[model samples]
Target: MTSPYRVLRSDREDPTVLRRELRRRTFPNPGLAERVRAILQRVETKGDQALVELTAELDRIALTPSELCRTEAPEPPAAPVRKTLRWSLGNVRRFARASRPRDWRMRNREGAWVGERFLPLDRIGVYVPGGTAPLISTAIMTIPFAREAGVREIVAVSPPPIHPVLYYALRIAGATEVYAVGGAQAVAALAYGTESIRPVDKIFGPGNAYVVEAKRQLFGLVAIDLLPGPSEVAVVADEGARAEFVAADLLAQAEHGSSSRILLLTPSAKMLEMVLSRIEEEIETLPRRSMVESVLRDNALFVLTRSLEEALDLVGEFAPEHLSLAVRHPRSAAKRVRHCGAIYLGDYSAVAAGDFLAGPSHTLPTGGSARAFDGLRMDHFFHRTSLVEYTRSAIARVEPKIALFAEIEGLAAHGRSASVRVAGRGRHKENGPFLRGRPPSAKVR
Candidate 1:
């Protein structure tokens, strides 16, 4: 029988081919972009009407403009769900609170006080994907941090047939408003605003390709958390790692979607064989077997490397969203990982821990974006404004130098403005506009 997953040997496969294979994971789709653009345009032009129409068409759930905004709060979740959500929220909040940066001021050598003032955004929009799954954990990961940052308005949007559990989770996580909307249309509404839903300052959370494309296109219009694509993971294991644990980690990431990428890099071929066998067996028992198989067919890989060093090099090149170090001295191995968005150390530390119970937000940068972007955090909700203060003495000390510098830059009025400030007067006839030019009478001479 054919192997369930492709096996690439570093000693045999060309490095260029390896890179090309990885690049396929992030290949651009014009069709997806065009579709997302249309949705965005429709929502931008038609407002709430477009949202209603698109939600019904795409999600197969009829909704009117009035129904866009959920009117009543959902009842509290059952004990088990509430308990888990509350626990997750507490962990996220505690971590966020501890990690949040503080506003600080320091006097410079010239006696000017300079500092950054961190202020919470007035409002933000959080997208919870209810299509394939409700993603209640997304609510816990996103909203609580906004709340901890003191965001005043937390607007939550998700597609129809939204699980009751999601509603309760949002409420528990401090969502001030909830709406029945999803996909690119929902992102557009949050970005541009509608008759009912006021535009938010920034939008957070993750979604499918359309949603990621929407965020990428609408980034400048409204502040965005990050352009996160499909979910992915890379596991760097060794002979010491358990095949079952490694197989489970790979399967966990694989079930995310067909577009998801899963990789296993190890020095031991035995470890690789064991993981592959375990995956084939365990995948048969999973509810999302088709999804796991779809990803495993093309996107997933089991790489055999000559050494651990080569495995780490492959990891840096991949720059996956979640990385698992299932080897002896996992912590030391983890230290070599410089690019992954999140690292799961040791066989005991499952990616699921970071996904659900871990304090850190599970919404991470994907599709090689982990090289530059960080996982969602509390600071994402706050805007930093720099504060500067200079006394008259401080201004006087630098005025002549400022004038000279402005003169050299050919801005006569810039020099004049500084000179006038030193003179303690407003703009006089001698000083023209901000640009360098002749005085009122000197022109035409």
Candidate 2:
């Protein structure tokens, strides 16, 4: 029987065929966008009342204002749970602390102390998905980085009937507030604010398409971690790579949702067939077999490449959120890949490790956005400002250049402003405006 997934040959088929197979599929839905926009406007206008109504209508859960805030925290997670979370937290925090940029100062050509100062945002909101899974790892991946960056406040939002494990993770990760809400409405509340939920400077984490769309619409209104549309993975394997390992990685990504995509590019036709067979056999054992099968049927692919270079080229074209190099020399093979959001080297380095226990946040760019965006990092929480300090001698040294620049730009008054500061004449004693308080006859050319 033919495999349920698409199998394309790069050597024998038209390049367009392979291109078509790799191109991301878009669901045309202006109605969904309009509806999300309306929901945002309603929450913005009606405040807490809109959140209460929308939670019942959309989430199928009822919540009052006080209940929405999750007034009291649950007891600390069980000993084992705490042990596991603390372990992961150490990895995430250590990596984040190492990656976080520091404020730096350097002297310029004019001897001015000019440099960049990094300051953490005042507040941030983290959205952890509740459907299908509680994603307790998301709390560890997102919140600790903000805390490590010294952010003033970190708020978390998830759909109601909060999972005990998720609550514990959020608390341990140092989330200042936890809200029981989800979907576009939750994003709207975080971006626009409501009576009970104060607005935040930025939002982080992943959700369904609606959540992604809401983040897209409210981008300028509030900062977002990245356009994490859906979970996706691309793997480049060689003949020596294990078929079961490749198939398991693909299936794990496919189970994320129907919209998720998985690509397997290799020159090994025999390995391709073996992985397909392994997938067919292994899928039946999974509880989410139907969901995995749907993704496999619609979005999964096993492409046959002419060479390793060809396979690596396709990896760059897809710009997958996660790229696994299952070849014999993963480190060397990874050098050719240019646009993956995260890279998992060797067969033993599973994407799940990066998603859960690895030192980096799994909140990464998706839907081909990895070409330009990066996985979420601690650097994302800070805003940078340039610091410029000039002494009187420094200002005097650059005054001619500054005046000439302003004059060339056709601003005579600007030129005078700079010259007057050094000229120290009349009312321009402290280098005030060059045009102000100048007598008609005393006007210098």
Candidate 1 C-alpha lDDT tens digits along 222-250: 99998777888999999999999999999
Worst 10 residues of 2 by lDDT: 436-445
The deviation in Å at residue 112 for candidate 1 is 1.3
TM-score of 1: 0.91
- Candidate 1: worst 10 consecutive residues by lDDT? 436-445
TM-score of each: 0.91, 0.92
- Report how far residue 361 has shifted in candidate 2, in Å: 0.3
Per-residue alpha-carbon lDDT of candidate 2 for residues 1-445, written as tens digits (9 for 90 to 100): 2676788889878897777657554453698899989988999999889999999998788788888998586778679888989999999999999999876655567665565768999999999999668999999999999999999899999988889889989988989999999989999999999888999999998988788889989999888887688799999999999899999999999988888888999998898899999999999999899999999998887888998889998888899999999998988889998888999999899999998989899999888878888989888999888866665666778999988998799988887776776777444223322222332222222
Query: Candidate 2 clash total?
Result: 1
